[model samples]
Target: MDFDNFKTLGEWDKWKGALAKAVDLGEAIGFNENTVDKMAYRIGNFLSSTVDPENREERVLQELWKVADESDKKVLAKLIVRMVEKDSRLH
Candidate 1:
């Protein structure tokens, strides 16, 4: 589904939709209910600064590790990486 090979102009709409959904999910996660948006925003912002383009997975994991307990940090790291990778693919 490379854009260069697109037949219909609208074929790339799916990528756009997915990108928007991913970003919105990230924003909502940033606006989390329990932790307050500020806390989550800080987390989300930190992830973005350190892991944009989905590079530096270990660095991202380490940063998350410092802030979160071991079990929760592992889970959070996976979710955040997925979100980032998804964003990279779509964008």
Candidate 2:
């Protein structure tokens, strides 16, 4: 539940699990994929703007976000959602 920890997570599987939990929370609140994706974008924006990357994945995402247009950021957010979804299914 502590989102700040996400930035610092070094293990990919742990990070993926955290995100999957977030997706589950969104679903519990009745958010569909599109809505969750949009929410993910907002969260991504906040992280990119306000948080320093504490791990390679966060650093990579922040780097990508820096060069991305708004449309591409949306795509990135959706891809993140899909990644987490795919990971969640394996557990």
Give residue 54's lDDT in candidate 1 (0 to 100): 27
Show how many residue pairs clash in every candidate, following the order shown: 0, 0
RMSD of each: 11.4, 5.9
Model 1: per-residue Cα lDDT over 13-84, one tens digit each: 443355446556766667333333234345555654575332234455556656776466546644654565
Model 1 residue 9 lDDT score? 29
Which stretches in model 2 have alpha-carbon errors above 4 Å?
A: 1-10
Instruction: Give the best candidate by lDDT.
Output: 2
What C-alpha lDDT values do all the predictions have? 0.50, 0.89
